[model samples]
Target: MTLLSYAKAMNRALADALEADPAVCVFGEDVGAGLAGLTLGLQQRFGAGRVVDVPLSEQAFTSAGIGAALNGMRPVIELQIPSLLFLVFEQLANQAHKFSLMTGGQARVPLTVVVPGSGSRSGWAGQHSDHPYGLFAHVGIKTLAPATPTDAYGLLSSAIRDDDPVVLFAPAGALGVREDVTAPLVPVPIGAARVHRAGSDVTVVAVGHLVHQALAVAEELAGEVSVEVLDPRTLYPLDRAALVESLGRTGRLVVVDDSNRFAGFAAEVLAVAAEECRLLAPPRRVTRPDGAVLPFALALDRALQPAAEQLRDAIRAVLK
Candidate 1:
């Protein structure tokens, strides 16, 4: 078995996409130098033309990528910082995402935007630490947050091949995750949820890096409570069927998301559950406080983000 790291898995996925399709091109700042680790060695392999590094303007380059998509090129834009997404909201949300529907399916924007090291990074402070996947989802953009190296590889590959504008957020907390690969990497379908562990007491829906925390809590609460860990890899076009099925079995839910609590991705999941599924007890959500801006201080940052203990408590609360 080969040990694959999450960052390496993403790099490999990008390399494979570059090799498989000439229409696939990468555009971003410092992509030639591979500062984000996901584009490492890709420029050398794919040549400077396919892996073009653009000017330091997020809006300009993002619009350029959208234009490239219109002209039959599948462009993958890598934003080194997640908050840069806020800078190009008009280009992404109003322009690229709406083009296909506006044209009545005449135009397709096969653009994949990758935000590596998304979410909180130690000492990166508030500006670089935002995990804004929810905003993209809210605007009807296809959003992905893969929790593991394997999921990272598969979901990224699928994102590159998608016909619509897609955003993939590689959470900083899961970047160091590693997994053993015994099979060849393949594309995982979008809007699918994976049940990491089976349980009958509570179904814990974890997003992005919180999937790891949910699994650990499940193992710890094995004797007293049966906790099922469900990873909703795709934030938008959520796997509502899988969610309903899991909640139907357990009759309890606890969503642990890295985003803020108000109108966040976790809130959407809870809304879906409340509307469609019958629960034995009230569902709980463990998420960051509303309007939380991560502090630069290490201790304060850790305190702001969701933790394993919080997830454990949420799970138990649902069970009770």
Candidate 2:
């Protein structure tokens, strides 16, 4: 029922969660001033106690979230840069994520670690430009990347409510996208994949911001071939059933992911398709080159990340 930017949608989602549940709290560097833009006005509405700002110690604050979650608080920790995740990997992968299973399901950590602007953002360079969702996914942590404003709002709400630890990667590419949403904002269930466009010739599985590029490419090739655009909103518990169903119809697959090619999210999708799906040709993945470190130069940075043209070429080759 409103038009909202991707960043505003996430801000609204956080506000909604805070208003709806008293137990839901947020902590991160600069959240008090809403530096990431997703927490703007939240600290004012919820007060400093609930929307607290922490020191610069990412490792300490990340584990503090785990501790808060253990005490029945739903804590959302925002990382200003995507690579900050690496700084707190042990806290998340070992402490928060493993609590539920390690305790034999007796304890649950409802913690949401949000990377607001992941992937290369112009000249942010190597340290700030990493899209590391695949790393979290490989560790079996609940991972999500919503491509649209609506999905951003819905999925973030769901992630906060989930019993397990969830990591949300809001790509820099999608941060500026705005949508005219008529329906009331609501939670989108995790582990569900949405078919953005239906087609019979090929299925293009796109992750995070790449979903928009995939849809655009699908439309551009509409006359030549029917390309199905599939968005697996949740990366960890990937909607394998939906993937298999799409593959059943399309018989071909091409994945566009922002992460690196080696053991990346796209690689996992291709690997699964190879193991279980019937394909007309060898599947292809469009991702950042293996071990790619985005450079400070704009052209060099753009070259390292997967492009729409690359996806189109991959789709064309897959259909060939």
Candidate 3:
């Protein structure tokens, strides 16, 4: 078994994909030098043509990836910052994602947009700290946020192989998580949720880095209330069946997400549970304040983001 950090695992997965598939190519700014660590050694393994370093135009390169995907090539575009997604939303949501349906399945855009270090990173402030996966999910794009190294590797591979446009958000909070991987790395199918901890009292659905917080809170509440930690690895094509099953066992739900409160990912989960599931008490969502702009100051930024304490309180409230 080998222990690998989430960041290094991503790099390894990119290298593995490049080596295994001749159709896979990557394009982004600073990818040649591996400035984000996720592309380290990838340019060396694959030539400069495959690991391309494009100009600073996000929209151009993003559309170019769609063009490449249409031509039977799988293109993985790396966005250095998470908020850059806003700059290419038209390319991803309107163009690459809709090509299949718009053209009646005549074209397939196998483009994977990987945003490493998404969400807050200390003093990166508002511009660099925005977590906009909810926007993609709302737009019907395949969206995934991997919480562990193994999931990071597996999900990235799956995203690259899928015949649709996919957005992979690698949270900054989860970048440090290390996992002991024993078996050979394989692709984890999109739209499957994993139950990290089983409990009968309350089912806590956590997205992205909040999965770790959910598990920790579950452990802390073991003596008082049983808490189940549900990690919805793929946010867009959520495994609703698994979530319904969990809600059936617990009869209570709490969602912990990194996005803002109003119309965020947490809001969608709550809406779905309210419509389909039978809950003993009102479900609660622990998320950032509405329209939060992550301040440059440390304390202010931390306050704006969701915390484990808030999740624990939400769980307790839901169980009560």
Candidate 4:
């Protein structure tokens, strides 16, 4: 048994993947230099031939990953910043994402895009701090936001193995997380929701770093309200069954997501529960204000993010 940090877990996964498959190659800005913490020392471990650093061209390099995948190579592309996803959206959504369907399963793009530090990084402002995971999920791209160090390793391993294009967002807030390893690291299924805490009252569905927040809130409200915390690791192929089962245990739902309220990931969970599950009360979502642009100030940035108190209040409201 060993202890591992989230960033180290990702690094280990990449190292294992590169070692397991000679066809696996990593290409992105500064990966060779290990500027992104997750790719630290990977270039040294694997030769420059496999960990080639590309020029600063998101669209071009993203398209290159698609091209590489179309061939026999498995390419892993790293975007240093989360918002850079927008720059490669056309390449991902139009080209790579469509190839499997457009080619009628004749071609597979086993491209994995890793966003090392996603979500409101303190004072990164509107452009860098944005977490646009919902956009990828909405467009049918396989999107995953891993909350724990173990899930970070497992999900990245799974994403690298999958034939379809996958986007992995490792939340900046959760990057510092460390986990105790009691069992061998293995691949976690893509579309699975993990129940962190079981409760009979309200179910709190959280994404990314918010899972930790929800669990903390659940513990705080242990005396009054029984809160069950659930983490939907994969956003696109949502585990509706697990969520429904959780709802069956607890008749109310509260979603606390780092994204915005309108058309956010939380909204989708609420919509799914409303359509499928029998809720005793209207589902509540604690998320950033509608179309929020996170300010550079610390207080302002923290205010825009969904807090545990907000989740607790939402849980209490739903319980009523």
Compared with the true structure, what per-residue lDDT tens digits does model 2 show for residues 85-166? Answer: 9999999999888989989999999999999999889799999999999999999999999999999999999999999999
Residue 108 accuracy (lDDT) in model 1? 95
Candidate that beats the other on lDDT, 2 or 4, i.e. the better one: 2
Q: For model 3, how does the per-residue alpha-carbon lDDT over 1-320 read when each residue is reduced to its tens digit?
A: 89989999899888888888999999999999999988998888788999999999999999899999999999999999999999999989888989999999999999999999999997999899999999999999999999999999999999988999999999999999999988998888999999999999999999989899889888988999999999999998989999999999999999999999999999999888989999999999899999999999989999999898898788889866
Taken over the whole model, the C-alpha lDDT of each candidate is 0.94, 0.94, 0.93, 0.92
In the range 1-320, model 4's lDDT, one tens digit per residue, is 79899999999999999999998999899998887787788888888888989998888888888999999789999999998999999999999999999989999999999999999887999999989999999999999999999999999999999999999999999999999999999999999889989999999998998898888888888999989999999998999999999999999999988988889989899999999988999989899999999999989999888987788789889877
Candidate 1 stretches with Cα past 4 Å from truth are: none
Candidate 3 colliding pairs: none
Each prediction's TM-score versus the true structure? 0.99, 0.99, 0.99, 0.99
Q: Cα deviation of 78 in candidate 4 (Å)?
A: 0.4
lDDT of 1 by residue, 1-320 (tens): 99999999999999999999999999999999999998999999889999999998999999999999999999999999999999999999999999999999999999999999999998898998899999999999999999999999999999999999999999999999999999999999999999999999899999998899888888998999998899999989999999999998999999988988899998999999999999999989898899999999999999989998888788777776
Comparing candidate 1 with candidate 4, which one achieves the higher lDDT? Answer: 1
List the lowest-lDDT window of 10 residues for candidate 4. 32-41
In the order shown, the candidates' Cα RMSDs to the true structure are: 0.7, 0.8, 0.8, 0.8
With a 3 Å backbone cut-off (N, CA, C), the pairs that clash in candidate 4 are none
Weakest 10 consecutive residues of candidate 3 by summed lDDT: 311-320
User: Candidate 4, TM-score vs. the true structure?
Assistant: 0.99
Per model, how many backbone clashes are there?
0, 1, 0, 0
